[model samples]
Target chain A: MEDRFEISLLLDFYGNLLTPKQKTIMELYYNEDLSLGEIAEINDTSRQAIHDLTKRCYKLLLNYEEKLSLLSKYNIREEKYKIALEDIKDRFKLSDEAINYINKLFEDINNS
Target chain B: MEDRFEISLLLDFYGNLLTPKQKTIMELYYNEDLSLGEIAEINDTSRQAIHDLTKRCYKLLLNYEEKLSLLSKYNIREEKYKIALEDIKDRFKLSDEAINYINKLFEDINNS
Candidate 1:
């Protein structure tokens, strides 16, 4: 299963693990879609600091992900569960047994 | 705000960005707290795949975080906002100005 969430979600999950400075730079660049020069001007920091911070923050996020793999798993499960639920809901001809099974499956998912 | 959420949260958010095999290995190792050998046994994959998967997943997560940063910001803002709301609610002697200010703050937070 080559399941992968969007890059934006990944950024949202790991950005806080960075330093405040790094976080700011990342937000400015990624979320705000600001240029490096614009971020530098806004923070009154050098463009170099912004660049270095972005690089270091990226490295930190990678390191953290390596040690812990929860974000990725959560994303995959959430997507799968959502799609499953939607598909079940969309099926108009689901029998009572199918409905019961789907309910049980959802319960198991919630419990997990 | 260096308001980082738990590592588990980060893992949950970023884990889905990996392959299904990688995501499974991660869930077994991190969420299930299983040993590498155990994960290997369960998945019928090599211990080396488990190790390498973990390593690569981590790197992918980090790279994703570097490029985008919503998770980090969301966590910090959520923490700060929760604390602020709790504190305001707990304060028994808040003036009308304070109440109005807090209400406005919460409104802004929700809108954001």
Candidate 2:
């Protein structure tokens, strides 16, 4: 998919929300870049099973995003932080500590 | 439980991520404030089943929070917005147009 990387990022945030089987298949297919046949062989399941599980996992992740919008909110928050940081820097020459504190906030937002 | 309200908020965000049964039970129990017996009677399931489903739903919501932390990030963002708003107001002596624009940003943060 064109948004495989984006989905991978969403998986990072909400992958644990899936069942163990779903999570394992997703890790194999997306992270490990395994083909359906390869995953089925590794897990001793039919390729169809792997395909269904992967589809279900993707749907579930999309559902989570639709309901929560966590990924979108994170991006918006990061953008706003950058804009505000720039505004602060431009309007008032902030102290080193102040800059460090804002930087820390940005890091915390990303890490969280 | 002590975090019933908090879980309800989490449910608002991630509840759609649950199964249909899980979502229904959670809605009846948490949002509608139904007892186990009431839910069981309405759903035509045993009280024990209702209780178990409720527990499972709680765990799922908690797991989602543990992984994604959307609510926590939201609170932190709101706090930072307030802090930054105050800082801008204090340091910049901004025009009314600027103040209104900042207020609009605050509203957007809260809504999103």
Best by TM-score: 2
* A1-112: candidate 2 lDDT, tens digit per residue: 5488887877887797887778888988888899999999999999999988888888888987887677897788677767765775565566666656655755564554
Output the lDDT of residue A4, model 1: 24
Candidate 2 chain B, run of 10 with poorest lDDT: B103-112
Off by over 4 Å in 2: A15-68, A72-112, B95-101
TM-score of decoy 2? 0.60
What does the TM-score come to for chain B in model 1?
Answer: 0.63
lDDT of 1 at B46: 89
Provide DockQ values for all models, in the order shown.
Answer: 0.03, 0.27
lDDT of 2 by residue, B1-112 (tens): 4488897888887887788778978988988999999999998989999998888889888887787677786677677766766775666566666656656755564555
